[model samples]
Target: MVDRLEQSKALASDVRLTILTWLKTPALHFPHQVTGDPAEIGVCVTLLADTLRISQPTVSRHLEVLRRAGFLRVRRIGRWSFFARDEITLSDYAEWLRDTL
Candidate 1:
């Protein structure tokens, strides 16, 4: 199970929230990817970094936080890493918030 506090902390950042929003609709927010489908395998860290105008390492750090919080699903394609929203966990978290709050 995902730790509620950790998940809350992950969502506390504006940048992290934006990243989640972008991942929610990657096709609209991101361009076509060659290696993997944006909606399937997820968006590349480099692409996210370019779009966010931040360093790749910085993006990776944010992604790591989300991943730890169970908000992200990661895929490794050769030398690259991709990230997408964990829909089930997201939905569960939303339901949890609705019930708890």
Candidate 2:
């Protein structure tokens, strides 16, 4: 489990939050993928980079933050990496926040 401080740091950025929000409904936020289903394969890093208008490496860094926070689930296909939100973790985090507050 990630410590509260690290989790807080991970979520403290607007980019990370937006990435999380976009993952909630990837089909709506991302264009149709040629090889894989968004729901099954998760959103591609290329799509995220295009959507954010940032370099792929930058998007990767943001994704790393969320991953470390336990907010994302990842799948690697060949050279590509796909990401999806870990809803269960988010739910637990939400509950923790509610109880803490």
Candidate 3:
């Protein structure tokens, strides 16, 4: 289906994959975000940008696309935006990857 293809296309990019990898490592992948502590909940946008060595807007854009595809869950704290892995879908993705390989 077009939806699956589109989501696959989104994940096909190295940058997006890298983002997922980063999400797995709290200390190294993200900066200190006090609002939505990754240690407690998830990573925030500013932290995601700083760790990725990219602009906030750029990272935000990528995150938006990923979120739209049911790959992530976003939270807001004041002006700060936070994101986390959608465990259910992520587990499915992992399972699919395993089956495919």
Q: How would you encode candidate 1's per-residue C-alpha lDDT over 1-101 as one tens digit per residue?
A: 66999999999999999999999998888766777679888999999999999999999999999999999999998999999999999999999999999
- Relative to the true structure, candidate 3 reaches a TM of 0.80
Residue-pair clash count for candidate 3? 0
Cα-based lDDT at residue 48, candidate 2: 92
Candidate topping TM-score = 1
Worst 10 residues of 3 by lDDT: 1-10
Model 3 C-alpha lDDT versus the unseen true structure: 0.76
Provide the lowest-lDDT 10-residue window in model 2.
Answer: 30-39
Per-residue lDDT tens digits for candidate 3, residues 1-101, read 22555567679777788887877776565556656458557788877788788999999999988887778888777777778878787787667768977
| Order of quality (lDDT) | 1, 2, 3
Write one digit per residue (lDDT tens) for candidate 2, span 1-24. 547778788899999999999899
lDDT of each: 0.93, 0.89, 0.76
**Best prediction by lDDT:** 1
Q: Where is model 1 poorest over a 10-residue stretch in terms of lDDT?
A: 28-37
Q: How do the predictions measure up, each by TM-score?
A: 0.95, 0.94, 0.80
Better of 1 and 2 by lDDT: 1
Query: Could you give me the TM-score of model 2 versus the true structure?
Result: 0.94
Reference-based lDDT, residue 5, model 3: 56
